[model samples]
Target: MTAPNRPNAPRWLPLGAAPTTQRRVFCFPHAGASAAVYAPWRGIAGDRLAICPVQPPGRAERFREKAFTSVDALVDELVADIGDQFTGDYAFFGHSMGALVAFEVTRKLRAIGAQPPKHLFVSGRAAPQLPDTRKQLRALPTPQLIAELKVLGGMPDAVINEPELLELFVPLFRADLTVNEAYAHRAEDPLPIPLTAFGGHGDPRADDDELKAWGELTADRFALHTYPGGHFYLEKKAGELIDIFAAELAG
Candidate 1:
């Protein structure tokens, strides 16, 4: 079952009614996405891990809220708002732009001496230190932006064809891209936590070497797993990926 709509806690969407569970897995979505993308994970994760999907502003229930344009500001607010959720065992799973946000939040939490995640699962994003090679899509015209999304292959064809949908989607999409593109990684000491990096073998945005570079950010165990697909590989490989997550968390 889906979690109740949390009007107060704007940052989290708890997957079930349980107050807590063995572990909490905070899942962050990619650019132009919302917590709904992770709703399926509620069943996939089972009871061992509570899937808490984050809902950033300017989308879904928070549609009226202004989206964050600065990554640093975003992380600062998230760390502060999350409060006691980090008290027990937890992990972070982020895809694409979300991975960078998760990484920054992890760093901010550690800096404040809060409890750190047992593991960090970063997917579809290169290590933060690597310079972004993708063309800046945030500044593209409406037609070009729509074309780029079509090439990315995650949005429904209906959404692409519907002009009314594009009216709302385009701005949010550009806002999210702007937030990600504006990010500037600040050097810091390597984290002591283990990190598991996931990448698509054919994804140009996150090459093998770039994914492997995640190792340098972790002082403990580091692993990289490549799946067979392009940028949105998780859509097709969710079951396999969730199995790996379950095994790792269980271990």
Candidate 2:
């Protein structure tokens, strides 16, 4: 697996493709995060699930580029880059902001008559149709945005306090917030594939009720699982989460 930080290369980094295997899993990271977030899951997933982490700009190797301010633009770039890799049976797992990206991408792929993922694992996000009261975070002052980040428990305290790091990350945060806030769910037909939503039991962002709303978007099958933690539940329960993922793939 390539480290999240490389000298000067593309931001997205994928890991663990068996030379002979046909299946692959595309993984997307949360807002203000890099592809390295899924590095630890590579060993747990083994060869059955070849993990490909999608890295957005303004982070990791794409740090110098301007971050995408719209979800549509980002997904377009993603499809252009990874469209050919959609030949085999594939699945998608996305967390927080990534979950939003995955859902939008699925819709885009379906519109173009491309192969959709076999399964989609959405973590730490509420269905787009649900009410999102935190939309104002996009307009919050710098200090307030940093404070909100601290409460989300994803960014390290040191990074949040560092002026240089904050300057680098704040724009990305705003871009994510814009993507989330500007998202509008048109009254379209439901997806034809199974949808799985996972979230922390105590996650204020996405509660059980909100997560279950994903069922309305998929006609095939829907499952919602809750773990014990705040926003970043996967951090504490990665082992059990991997087992759940393995079982899902096996089934």
Candidate 3:
């Protein structure tokens, strides 16, 4: 295989390097999350798979950039930005809104005849075909939005309580939610890639049935795993989750 072109990388931050290994795992974070969210995975992934976390706009170091408000636009920009990084064997792992972004990015890569990931791990999200039944929260007022975030338990209490911090977070959250809510699934033949669907058993946002529906999105193998927590289950199960990813990607 031809080597991927080496250029100034964009939108990707390498957590650690496993130079001996040929495969990489690109992780996309949930809504309002930054690349730091995957810091723990750096150790658990061992020395065989590099953990590269995606840094979306308007978060962390990219706070000066505008966050994407549409999935299509985000995918297009990511594909162009990443360029030749797809030449080698790689996998994608995404959680919540990140799952949708990863899925769509995979599709876009395939659409353009670019290389596809060896595996796709989607967590804390319903299958794309399933209609999102959750009430639209993107348009909710500031206090109401903060309340929803509190219920989701993704944001830290310190961040939630700080008005100055919330001023930065609320817009980023709104932009991400807009992207999530505005996404419209387009019908196509199932992807040939293997898929693993993961969720929280008690996640009100995504249930077992919705996760199982991911099987229909892939033409190859499909598996589902649920942990004992709510929507942000991976936060508590990161080690176990990394074990599963290491095993599957090693295969």
TM-score on alpha carbons, each prediction: 0.93, 0.90, 0.94
lDDT, candidate 1, 11-92, per-residue tens: 4553432344466778889998999999998788787567878888888887888888888888787766664566566788
- lDDT tens digits by residue: candidate 2, 1-251: 22223332234554433221345567888888888888888777776666677787778777888888788998888777656555456778899889999998898899999988888889998998787776468889998888877878989788876899888888888888788778877767999988899899888788888899988999898988888887899997877766666667667
Tens-place lDDT digits, model 3, residues 173-216: 99999988888899999999999999998888899999999999
Ranking by lDDT: 3, 1, 2
Clashes, model 3: 0
What's the lDDT for all of these models?
0.82, 0.79, 0.85
Cα-based lDDT at residue 222, candidate 2: 92
TM-score of 2: 0.90
Candidate 2 C-alpha error for residue 219, in Å = 0.6
Clashing pairs in 3: none
Q: How many residue pairs clash in each candidate?
A: 0, 0, 0
Q: Model 3: which ten-residue window has the lowest total lDDT?
A: 12-21
